[model samples]
Target: MKQRGFSRRSFLQLTAGALGASLLAACGSSEASQPTQTGSGGGGAQPTTASGSPAPAVITGVTLRVVGTGVTLLEPIREQAEKDLGIKLEYDVNDGPAAQQKAATQPQSWDLYDQWFNSVKIVWGSGNAAPIDINRIQEWDKISPMPKEGKLTPEAKEGDGDAPYRILYVQPDNTLGSIPTEQISMLPLTFNVDSFGYRSDLVDEEDVDSWAILFNPKYKGKIGLYSDPSTGLMDLALGAQAAGLATFQNIGNMTREEIDTIMEILIEQKRAGQFRAFWNSFDESVNLMASGEVVVESMWSPAVTALQVRDVPVVYASPKEGYRGWYGGMMLNKNASDKVLDACYEYLNWWLNGWAGAVVARQGYYFCIPENVKRHLSQADWDYWYDGKPAAEDLLDPFGSVVAKAGSVRDGGDLVTRVSNIAVWNSVMDEHQYLVTKWNEFLAS
Candidate 1:
């Protein structure tokens, strides 16, 4: 069953009122839109050199310190941003929990926060993150409706939990709300729907079409799971329900009893040796699958793509129950100096400028401003990734590894088809701290 925060009619009305114009304009063109040179602190500020090459901005004497998980923090991204923005960058990459801890308690440590939309509650509650001024976003109007309207089209399902639009705008009382405003809680960035990946050589493709397969006794001791409480719990609940073990009224916001019941089931499985390992990082997930220790697991897109590069027969499942959607974005720290803030804004605008978006799109992600990403990609690449068509030529990842070969189509089909089937979203539960406590217990068991 699909979960929702509001009725369908109210949702449509709210999104149409808030984001209809921008969505219509964005999808109207397949061509790239030029950056606008309006607003303060680096909106449309990429000046060209006299020789017809892109020139770096004039920001000087500032280094933007960014904190995020390994998913988005890459050496190549740092080098590209430094070259394009004329500023130095330092990345303190951590796993989900550690990154959130630092971001919530250590505001002095980072100028820009790069993480998922679910962590907005902890960081914003800590008062460490500042509201982003949407006026300074050079391509705000070109962003897709997914983050702003909670669905790409009015008829698409509104997935459960904190869909970015629910917490996107800054309200009059300095809280996040659905109403439109000049300031925002996070600057929308890369995002995609998520599901498990399985080895085609070990598991029959037909046998692994549902989340319940993860809990099947046939795969016991060969399965893997993510270690993060927020996402991992959702995966477990999905499997539990699909396996006919238990049902939750709302999987995203489980009650205390529901949490206990799920934890009990997990503990029983752990003691029975039903899992191989719990991965906490992208590299760990890749290594686990590559080394033949994990036949199946909850997976991110890049991990599946990386395995495909090695000729491993891994298939990212398009589960019958639907996908767990997520969004990643940039947030500002409250402790930034005006100079640093300008530099931060410059970096933020650079992310939406197509170059960075194109890089991540290579790894199975869709950018907010898809038109700009289209400019940086070849027609064949765009058709394969966005149109759900077969690859006309070999498609490579950001790091030059071939992920998809000629005649291969993306696993979930087109972008719209993939997102339209979302069953839930990654969320920060009301009982988040309690959930974490129980998750640790399950890990120990």
Candidate 2:
């Protein structure tokens, strides 16, 4: 069940992605309207200062409003950005669903959105979002081509052109949204992977090598599932692929029939009362595992770290099937002034090249600019995080025990394989609605 008192924070910190979504919606005020800036001819448009200077004092003495889902680790980074850029950053945090609802109803209230692929598609399809000007970004060329070149609908290929959104940030894998240019609509934020979290006190390590631990009847009423459909469904698909019922490529290109088959298996498991709880928030999932209410569940890297920090007797498994993952980036809002926009770029560049990536890595999550930050991290740091060994100190709690161990992708141990395959999962999701429906029915049953 969805946890009470778990407020959704903005997903993107530096970008004004998820602000004011809930307040106006609850108040029923339509005061905000989506803002669109006219694109300049040669370079991106520049906003004039009151003094008529070209740049507006380097974003000093200015406040930029950003919105998104919140992460505890990012609070310090937000403060650092404010100090470095000479700008004050105000944030509004909401979850993916709430953010999408607000963006749909009051587009102008939020400057940008840091959400999953489904939410991004909804905003783009509804004409609520503005297209980005990719030309002004300095490192635009560093972005991978999948997100930029992949949006070609046949009609879009004609005069319609690609969708107006520019990717300012991107996860290494383009599962959730496109990679953004320095001036793109979105920017890459952090790199994260998904794994099966289990109670070391209950399940033996050898017996839980595969995804089967989730469906094991012996653990009925002790399993947890994420409330979000996308992650759960992806887990099901990955589990099915691991069990030899399907291949990752097959799951990616799943037909309705294939989805139905997978869904049927999940429904059967659900009917058997396998799930202990369905978690809707990060805290809920972490708490459930920490308190021993759940023995196993699909989980992200950071949350597992959080639990370990609390001295929870849990371990993140490298299942035989492989881990699931996603990447995120920073995006610019069309409504942001040019000065604020430049400050956003400065923050993005510094984040990718500076200590920000290292800070993120310490929390057991990867940063998008892995290459640039390699020298900043130590060999032991690389082994524990990227190489998949457990680090001794818990960056999240500082008192938690080391939890993760290194493994291979084929043996369910690789992180890169998880993030790089999000697009494939998107395609698989399209064909797997029947399966999703079945899974939902199973949950209800």
Candidate 3:
């Protein structure tokens, strides 16, 4: 799901309006329709420069235009890219859906798209994305075969042939997209898995182990849920799996009747007043948890980490059913000038080699690189991180107080059930609208 505040309906409506405008704009046929160049000159692929050469083959004196959400995690990488690549990196911040709309209208203006997996589909469907030359990117070979196929295949219908969507970027070994670029199209950045975040001060351990805890009568009106239908529906599907109502293997092939059955259980849960608030952003989620407005809620790793940073007395728990997760990669804009493109490649290589990975690990998310970075870290860092060793002194927040433990999945008690199968999620997204409507009706009734 696109991590933005707009409702799904609102986003669709906006896209429809934008499409109409784009069609009208096309009729005018102005120079604006063409891509505007924004970087240093350099065209044909050149031979690799040797180390210590006066001028490395590196693209210089260029500005790479990147457009995406202004999430906090990207800042450090952005700064590093500018320094290491010797090029200016420009960012255009847009919420996920908005990014798609902008890209569709001004496809040539931007060079790279940093977005969620689902938003990537919308961007490609709108014909805003450029075809990636797989042969040019050396790291493409590292990607697993399944996601490679997913990027190549378009979104297929119930019985139609495979979809033919072109993958521009992909996270390595991550199923979120196809085509791995060391930096753009697909370079593994971080692995962020989702699990239930609950108030340890309220819910007991035993009661919170299963998906049923979200619907338990005692916690009615004290739970939180994401406003996005995709997340809520996925959680319900996971719960259905736990209830023996469904399984991941069957989830993809489920008939309408099966989907309706899963929807019914979620509807019933909604009718019971389970959700206290439907959070649409990280700030809102943090406020909800910190204020004690919610006892338990579906949460991503970052949010849990944020809460612990504030000493909210919360714990991220992996229920018996498992956790839902996603991994993201950077994609180069097809419109980027050769200079900017080369700079992007340099940044991408640097990120993968361990610097960016270490920073992400500090934020409680896993980086996609191999495990050797641990050797460079101090004992305290390793213990507090990989080993899940609780801090003897309470972790302090900006305001100065004790912090909560947001346990790692690698730790024994926090085992996460993997949920990265794209085929399964695609099927789930197909049924998302119906699920959301049913859930809304349940909330109303």
| C-alpha local distance difference test of each model | 0.80, 0.51, 0.52
Provide C-alpha RMSD values for all models, in order: 8.8, 11.1, 10.1
From the highest TM-score down, the ranking of the candidates is 1, 3, 2
lDDT of 3 by residue, 1-445 (tens): 1211212333354345434432332332220011111223245443321111112244667777777665422666667656655677777876544555566567777777764444444454454554444554434454433234432123321111111122334334322233334322334355444667889888888777777677677888998876555555566566667756555544433445666777677666666676687776777788888899998887766687677666677777756654554545555566655566666655455444455555555555554432433543445444565556654343432223333343422322211223222223322233434544564565455
Instruction: Give each model a TM-score.
Output: 0.87, 0.67, 0.68
TM-score of 2: 0.67
lDDT of 1 by residue, 1-445 (tens): 2322322233333223222222222232121765644444445455642211245446766899999987788877888888766689999997665677678767889999999898776677677888899887868988998899889988888787788988888777776767778999899898899999999899976678899987888998999998777788899899999999999987887888999999999999889998888886688899889888989999998788778878787888998888999999989998876778888887887787777777778888988888888888888889988889999999987788787888888888998999887878998776665677687788778
lDDT per residue, candidate 2, 1-445, as tens digits? 1111101122232012222322322232110011112222124444532212122234577666656666422666567666554567666676655665656556567565554433443344344554444554334444433334432232221111111222223223322233433323345446454667888888777757777677666788998877555557667667666666655444443566666677677777677777788886778889889888889888866677666656676777766554554445444455656666565545444454435566566566665445544555665566566655544432221223343333311122344544432322222133333444455565567
By TM-score, who's the top model here?
1
Q: Please estimate how well model 3 matches the true structure, expressed as its whole-model Cα lDDT.
A: 0.52
Question: Of the candidates numbered 2 and 3, which has the greater TM-score value?
Answer: 3
Question: Candidate 3: worst 10 consecutive residues by lDDT?
Answer: 29-38
